[model samples]
Target: IIGCSIAFNLAKLGAKNVVLLEKEKMTGMGSTAKCSGGIRQQFISPANILLSIESIKIFKNWQDEFPYPVQYALDFRQAGYLFLLHSKSQIENFQKQMALQKKLGVVTVGFVNTHEISTALPYLNISGIVAGVFCASDGVADPASCCAEYEKQAKMMGVQFLTDVKVSDIGANGTTRRKIEVVFTNKGSMLTPCVINAAGPHAAQIGKMLNIEIPIICHRHQTIATPPIKWMKKNDPFVIDYDDYAGQEFYFRPEAGNENTGYQLLLGGHEDGKIQIADPDKYKEKIDQDFILYLADRAMNRFKEGENIQILTKSGIAGLYESTPDALPILGKTEEVEGFILANGFSGHGFMHSPIIGKIIAEIALSGRSSFDITGLGLDNFKTNTRPPAEKAIV
Candidate 1:
């Protein structure tokens, strides 16, 4: 979505001959299609909070700005996100984090006590819950629909998309690195001044084609859905029970409708550890039912209402989290490669931050630098001598 959005914005700005290349037979067939589609501005870092705020604005008014329909109305309910806290120490920590978030101009985040949480979510069995944080602007959307819309809008704006054409290699020219030439499968070759690595799981490998070592790894996440239940509402926000013993193991929310059509649940188990894979094609897609049961057990312990829910479907996908040394993204340019730009490592927040990233990358590609200052996300931050602190609100 970020790549297509950037391409669309570039073409809209009168940049002629803009082309997009995809390795698959269709666009958004990769990890993008498997995202949970959660958009939240309740982050601990200032940069991420700002980016999410700006992206939410674009998502809210996409139809007004773009001529074509982006199919964004996949039940964007702002019922508010609730993060549970079981321990007193965790509650204090959340209070500090909420304070930082509020100081950074995040108006929707606030600390809520146990009584407030019980009153807000009557269905939840908050036996051990003490306090929590709520962010009204944090919500969910349909990932597949959003990605398709971006591609559709980009196509309408005269951007040529070449599917099933894998980028074989990229060749750079000039002694001081002035231009880049990309070689793809069916399209033959094309010379451009810039290239953006939005390849998701294969981003690090794409950087390796130019001998640049990007610190990113692939992680597998599983999601399940339940059969229709009467108590669940369609407009309920994405819920996170932070008090799980497994450490942020699960998240649940309504699918799209309110006629008791069931709810969708996403689980990231503690036992389902991340595995390092060099090739994207070698990923495993089959989900472990045992892991799902483990996560479901943890979730049911918190929300007793879930124990009787019937699971309708369960599936897994291989998506790259693209973790940095500090779990943040490496955006901007690298000193080792001249024309090579870095935009990979999003840690799992790529979808939520796609709009801001697209705009910033477009500005950098067209005008040689981003209007928004990205010095904190520079590639040199991972050079061992100067590493940035890890942002604490990644869950």
Candidate 2:
């Protein structure tokens, strides 16, 4: 999605001769196909919040915003995102973050007490919950539809796409100067002055070909979809058990349903301190049995109608997240190389941030810098080991 969005924005910026190369037979066959597709602006980092705000604008008004004649449905929902807070410290931190969000023009975000939360969602067992922060503008969308629309718009704007073409190496002019000259791919070599590293989970490998150490690693995450239930609320908001009580942190949201299936949900989360660093190409694609059992038990413990829910095992999927040290993306140009821009390491927020990041990267490629400030997301921070404050919201 990021790559396609970059291409589309580049074309929109009047840059011709833009070409997108995909290793797979099609675009969005990697982590994008497996993402949970939650879009929210509740973040501690100002940079991420700004990116989300910009992207959500497009997601909310793509028909008016995008220049495509045939705009596809993104299946976007503004049912809101609620964070279940348990501790006083968590509440205090959220208060500060919510204030920052409000200052940044996020008027939909507000604090909700435990009673309000229970009143809103009657099925939820708010036993240990203290308070919650809800963002009415935050919601979910269909990742596949978004990517398809991006690809279509970009192609219509004269951006060329090459599928089943794997990039093998990057060539520079000389040892003294770092400048991109050519890209060697499986099909053939192509000469291009600029290259954008939007390889998703396989981004580090691409950086290695240029002999630049991209500070990114892949982590495995899984999500599951449950069969439709008659009692399921179609307009239910996306809910997150923010506090890691008993080492379990779960999140769930309603999935679109048909007449046959009344209403369903998509649910998953991470266990506290369980970091499964994985190979992007070699990791397990199926969810673990133990994890499935754990989610079922956790759901039953948290919701009144959870016991009646049945997991669609075949609907379970796992994907890789190209993560960074501070839970933020590494964008902008790298000092080690010229004509080589970095747009990697979104840490699982790639789909949500794709639209704005696409425009920012196009600005960097065509012009020298982005219209938005990206000083906090540069690669120099990792080199000097002086990073900005980490983003606190990651599920």
Highest-scoring model, TM-score: 2
lDDT of 1: 0.71
Candidate 2: where is the Cα deviation over 4 Å?
A: 245-247, 259-261
Prediction RMSDs, each to the true structure: 2.4, 1.5
lDDT of each: 0.71, 0.88
Best by lDDT: 2
How many Å off is the CA of 387 in candidate 2? 3.0
Off by more than 4 A, model 1:
69-74, 176-178, 244-248, 260-262, 266-269, 272-279, 316-318, 384-387
**Candidate 1 residue-wise lDDT, 127-176, digit = tens:** 87778788988887776767777778778888898888888787765676
| TM-score between model 2 and native | 0.97
Q: Write the per-residue lDDT of candidate 2 for residues 205-302, one digit (tens) a residue.
A: 99999888888889888889888866567677889998754555799988868656667778899876775999987999999887788778878888
TM-score of each: 0.92, 0.97
How many clashes in each structure?
0, 0
Return the clash pairs for model 2, or none: none
